[model samples]
Target: MNRSTVDVTFVVGYLAVAIGLLVARSNPATTYEPSIYTGTPMITWVTFAVALAIAVGMALTCRGREQALGIGLGAITVTGIVSLPVIRNYRFAGMGDALTHLGWTRDIVAGELAPHELFYPAIHSIASVFHYAGGIPIERALLFSMVITFVPFLIFVPLVVRELTGPSMAIGAAAIVSWMVLPINNIATHMGVHTNSNALFLAPVVIFAVFAYLRRRATIERLPLGLSPFSLLVVLSGIGLLLIHPQQMVNIVVLLGAISSVQYIVRRRSDDHPILDHPTMYAHTIVLGVVFGLWALSNERFRDALLILVVGLLTEDVGSGAEVDQRGSSLTEIGGSLGELFVTMFLESAIISLIVGVFVLLVWLGRTRLAPEAKSLVNYLAISMVPLTGMFVVYFVGTPTMAFRQLGFIAVLLTILAGVAISRGVGTLSNYVSRPGGTAIAALGLSICLVLGLMTVFASPMIYDPGQHVTDQKFSGYESGFEHADEDLPHAGMGYDPYRYDHGLNGVEGDGTLSGATVDSGTVDSEAFEDGDYADAYNGIDYYFIMTQYDITRELGVYQELYYSEDTLEEFERSPEANKVISNDEFRMYVVSSTE
Candidate 1:
């Protein structure tokens, strides 16, 4: 077959496999099975291998530099498609954070916001829009939301890399390098962190806006109607990020602020201040701040949360009210924590990409006459890194999990830097080689990138035998327990639905109970339950649904240790007011007979 024919055949065959995997993995018939890997494991692995081979082939056989670059872009797209089914296989609903988002989506669709602590509501709103406007079911809406929030990151990373470093074979390599290196890279498929994931989708758009603003300023062009579209996008995306995830909103603000500051510093040092060099850019920043401030002030909850977060940061006690065991680690201890973090980043990222990033940093540092734009970009990245690093230190001192959330943005920045380094390093190398030699070198780079990309995708904890957040046995038991409780209980005043069991009890309502009202698990004071405060806390509730030992034990460590403790379970069993209404291996429901 001709080269074109081969390419066409490969594309078609890959699509077929992708579609088949989706069908096989999402098949409802086998969803209730005990095994998480329902699809043939061998077939899944083989499909991934084939996709990687095709990506490498495309990169190696491309006729020109652009075509070869397309291979890198294609690898990202292909990896996303091929990895989705593998991640979603035998797991329709994600665990923990994903389950919480799913509950929020259901509440939004039902036109009733649950009277629970409000988190980033934009994700739920987006999913609700999908469900109501598109006439899709909650499951599909949730799935679509996951895809929309995640897939953009894949596209955005490549765009940022290509824009930062002029297009070369290294652009694709850099893209893969970024994907492999990011610690939170698995967020694309993990599906639980709806807010963070959604915020990330807009991160690239913001980066692109910055890129455009810089390019426009360089040419001394006027900000016309054409610029308004991207500016509008930046404004809207900023607002959306603010509503969805506070950390990401802060990241965007910091990034934009850092860029502007760097530009100012550069201009001042050079004694050059051009007139309206970036009119639209400044306008974008002003509008973002004004609108965000107004929106936050308008909502009491948002305003309060903002104040609390700010206060927490200022006080060096981000988890002030939380019942955490905070013995305040020393600076040396904090340094140890940060040390482990850097180690993880180094170990997880592609080694070659790290080397290339070091090379680029060294080369940039050694250069005396760098372009103003490049200098500003480098300075902005450096400035951005400090705040994130500090946030990690603060979180480590206050709350460890909060530090983990901060890793997403840190990973992105590191990935972009690495991509720049890889692109520059490869571009320099290619300059001295013959045409064939360059092509061969590019092919070898592409091959290494493909292998790394594949490892990143398939080896992610989300894809490769992930934790038992959701299983057929667990979900089925949870659903059955809820059904039994609904039938046995008289009122709708149910107590805390621990581990977000409300996703199973969607249409059915017994009492006026809101989901997740009281915290029955986690690092909270379990002493209350042992001291007979449980009955008083859940006084008005008619029924309490609790996850069984099996299901609870199979959950993430924090949740497992919190809820499945022998003392907690013993307290529940011994409570005279709490009569067992329904019991199963996965969950148990008790009737609050005294309250009823």
Candidate 2:
């Protein structure tokens, strides 16, 4: 189809999906909670509607389909942002773990005026305003934040590629890239991974800035033009990204700049460094560094990480957090916190990356020969891998905070690469497929591949037998320091990995290693071990709820090690103070009171 036809199709498809999302969410019988609704008929219907719309718009916008596609993406980004506060108000509703934390963060940050407490203060501040202006409940605002976060990539990815490869190739690449699901990339979109939000916004802003810098420099080179607004915009975008999530913005820019610097260095050796000679590039880099540097210095964690990396020259292991141990599985881990990096990438990121890789490889192989520009595109794409590797490292080593959320820029890069690869592959195949009867065969093959893939993906949700609605079942288990409902604990102290127990039915036996310990009232101090103490002493609010879950599995030795020891344990086990043994389908909830 032609451009106009494609635009019409895109708009129409998007509208239909919007209507479906509205209707499904509007349903009185459904709460729109992800856990309860995820595999339900309502969710299925909504997914189908949304996916259909996305597919249509995507197909129509092929070959640098920026305008229509960009709007659709922007709309979603707005929606995610709006959802943030709503999720918070209805925190008890299980939208997902990510949604839960997002909701909590939104409320606490808004109420306490502690956006600074979050890893990415800027994004949270903007989100806070969005929540306040809309008069949305905290829960909904959280959800909205998630929706809006996805917008920039939708617009920026196609635009970036189009600048390099022309509209047709851009469209083809986008279509192919749109489907990949990389590891821990959700840090850009989800509430649970708030730090990623900063990264999400920053990545695109940087790209837009880079593009503008290029334009302004070209103007100066050709016509001795005055300072272009494009360069200003680039600088502003970098500032915005830094304000929102400086740490991620810095990491992303530095990683890319390092590669670019290498290119410049190589050129300098041969006396041919265009990027170095270009004042625009130089200005963009310098300004970005300064702005992002200031932002980084504002946060303790970011400041510490940076100081350790650049000034102190501390080793990665010493500076990293414990989470890094599980970022990716062994298969995908690249560098830094090798063990955890592997877990994070393989378990969380691989799906998206793998799908994109396959399609992009096809495009690359099909091209047969690469153009000089294409070769440059390939270099930039390769440079992106550094940040992607960094993401794996951070996922395992560092906390994925709102400031870190923008790290998903790697997701955008991966998507772009995949798109480029696929377009090239299809271009290559077009030659052989043009023969008599060959087009028909190729079309049939494509159809079969698509159908099979969809079937495989949808199979789990489709065949899942809906059992009796047991939403109110009592999850129970009694442990040492405290008592808890079974629903709270998961196998091996992994706590609840929502990915595994999506429906919340299966009960994993608590290992009691860090769980199932019993604390005697005399062994611990009442003031020290009190629930409020955890919050006061450790900024322990986040860990408080998680510790409560372990009460059911805590045993003598296990529970005794707790700082609060006896008094805290007694408070958990006995009560007129809300301590009681309440049993449910999976586990029992116990109210306890303690006397130190």
Candidate 3:
């Protein structure tokens, strides 16, 4: 067979073996642990690691289109590894956010909530469509939408990277390695069903279009396809971004506005400015900006939320050196382990940061060789980081605006830059060594290991596994508990979300139970059992929930500092003030007698 044919066959065989093994071994966790590998079985992750290693090896080694295909295959498989558990255990994964989204989706489907009623409705709106059209459950549909949003990364990342540095084997590797910044978050940019994360995924399309215009790529000549693909994508994705999460849309608006303003200035000075190639970007940017402004004003939910944020900024000591809160540490605080804290905060993100670092250094080192469009992006990223750093400082010192979430945005842009860096690194290395074959192989091997490691960290709850996708039986216990709750007295979970989503859905007229405030699981399990001490320790609440998730956190010590042991039944059974009103193993709710 020809080399291309052999490469193609290898690629196809690898993809099938990897994906098939993953599916065959993948099953929902019988007993919930934040780590799917331990919860499901050992083989699941072994297969994943093996499959990833092979894919990454080839992605770095193979040449031309075959390599690009390898990168896409590797990326899809890694995404699948992350998403499979959520799909398998669909109902109430990621604790409350998914449930809240489900509730909103349910409302949207039932005609109880209009799409515009929420600021970010594209995900829910699309999920609703998928649920109805595909005849799937609402939860699965949302999960499906979340994974589907990631599909664009495979296309746009490659496109942007290729645009910046021409094409090379490193472009393919970038696709796989870029998953480190997927942006592999548990918060706003989480791989799970987050609306802003979806918006962030589509951001490369906007960036790619901006660069495509610099190349003066032609419009489609056929009827009904008159516009350039970038222009059309800009329009559609611009609207999609606005609907999915306007926070990202606002960034695109600013990006396009800057590009547009430059074009206008260059046009006025010179009839056809060579530097600012895209003449029409100015109008598109202005239109998007106006639409964004109108959206901010018209959406009452967003407006009120913005005002609340404004109040936080106004009340905060922004000028104060951004001191971290000196609150008392919980038993789960890692006990002042600065190294672990730093690893958790920075090490997981080091891959993406390293890529951006390399990219910045390359811009200075090879400035004359870079395309004008790439140079412009470098300048923008540098200028933007000043404000971005300041905002993060303010947020760290306790501002209501969640500045950390913007890392997802920066991560998206950085992934494209990584592509350029990887290709340049390969080229530079190739030029330096006369007999570079062994060194090249070693470098590729190291690259493959990093890709595999990043995928595991980014996708699975390895480094942090306290909170996880809830098991079916465990979720069932909550549903069953809410069904038998007392209407008058208040109830609260010991950690995380407090089962308040279900309470709100049940529309129970209970007092503090519906507020979603949570207590420490340790306080629930080990506090004094004296007449009034036990009751007051639960914070005047009537019911204390000992959840499987809290137990998992308690066991893994992921994010639960104060949460106690998993077998709370023994402890609760010994308590005099607490009565085990609800229990079926996975979940237990103790009714604290107010009379005590």
Model 3 misplaced stretches (Cα beyond 4 Å):
1-5, 8-26, 86-90, 217-229, 261-274, 317-336, 361-368, 372-401, 434-465, 503-532, 539-541, 544-546, 555-569
**Off by more than 4 A, model 1:** 1-23, 26-40, 56-91, 114-119, 178-190, 217-229, 271-280, 297-346, 350-353, 356-360, 367-379, 427-499, 503-596
TM-score against truth, every candidate: 0.70, 0.59, 0.84
How big is the positional error of residue 395 in model 2, measured in Å on the Cα after superposition? 8.3
What would you estimate as the lDDT of candidate 2? 0.43
Shift in Å, residue 457, candidate 2: 14
- Residues 241-291, model 3: lDDT tens digits: 899888788777766765655556666787643555544676567778888
Model 3 lowest lDDT segment of ten: 513-522
Where does candidate 2 have its weakest 10-residue lDDT segment? 461-470
Candidate 1 lDDT over residue span 90-204, tens digit each: 3444555566677667666675674223446776777778878999766556666666666666667767655565544445555555445354545232334456755755576
lDDT of 1 at 217: 38
Please tell me which model should have the higher lDDT, number 1 or number 2: 1
Q: What are the Cα lDDT values of the candidates?
A: 0.53, 0.43, 0.60
TM-score-sorted candidate list, best first: 3, 1, 2
Candidate No. with top lDDT: 3
